[model samples]
Target: MSVMELLASRRTYRRFEQKAVPQDVVEDIIEALRLSSCGANRQAVRLVVVNRPEDVARVQPLVKWAAYLPPEQGTPKADELPTLYVAVMQDTSIPGDLATDTGIALANMTLAAWAKGVGSCIMGAINKPALTRLLGIEEPQKLAFMVAFGYPAHKAGIVPLTEQTGVKYYLDEHRDYCVPKRSREEIARYL
Candidate 1:
């Protein structure tokens, strides 16, 4: 699919089927991330791929998913959790904030994952300190965010920004996950 089509179809999927993402595919995704542009070409951003069952189980609780979801629909249940996770990190030795580089790497990985029929959710609301400690990530390498990946078990679609469809995502009565995005006209204008 084309880049615009990929972007248009991409959505943050919380529920995933019980399937495994191949090691080589994850490696390719990381390779894509590594090839992405970095600030000053410093390459401060790094990734930790966690797909093992034991490690995935340990890392699951440390993440906070879908902040906009109501209490009744909070966290994903065991069966609904992701099958893989990519921990985005920044190396402190690089000597600058790597937020932009992190974003670039994440975007590359996300698109790559989507192209492979894998769904993803980029989450920033993670318990970094606990995650780092659990994953044995030391000072120089600090966790920035995480991206969860798996074959989606539920559907998510976008709608134009409107009062009926506010900025936040929600599940309709039929349980369809709907994301509301601002229209181009609302986000841009002639110079």
Candidate 2:
């Protein structure tokens, strides 16, 4: 699919089909992230892959929505269990620009996952101190994202909004229960 189509199709898939993504495919996604632009060529980003049941189980202790997310229209039920997880991080050795550099690489990986027809949800609601220990990340290294990947279990459809809706939160609208977005004008700004 074209870049526009891919961007339009990207969704935060939490629920997933119980199928394993190929190891090579997973590697390719990480490779794409690796090739993405890095701030000052700091190349501080580190991607940790989790596919095995044991590995995924370990992450549950680290992830939970920071708070109850609002109900969204036409949003699909994310698979509580994802077969794969990618943890994006940055090396501490890089000085003065960890956050910005890591963010760019994280965005690249997110888009790359979408381009592959794999759905992902980026999580920031993590216990940093615990995660750092859980993932064996050392000083100067930080976990920036916990990305979940899988085939969607629901058929996401266009989600509408009202003029009064200030935040662009999605919801389950279609009867089939897939999560799709509405037109760009409803969410984008030209300026």
Residues 51-144, candidate 1: write the lDDT tens digits.
Answer: 9988999999899887888755857788888999988889989965588888888888988888888999898999988998887888888899
Output the lDDT of residue 34, model 2.
77
Count clashing residue pairs per candidate.
0, 21
- For candidate 2, the lDDT comes to 0.68
Model 1 residue 23 CA deviation in Å: 1.7
Residue range 59-122, candidate 2, lDDT tens digits: 7667754133433322223444677888888777776577777677766777776676677777
lDDT of each model, Cα atoms only? 0.87, 0.68
Candidate number of the best lDDT: 1
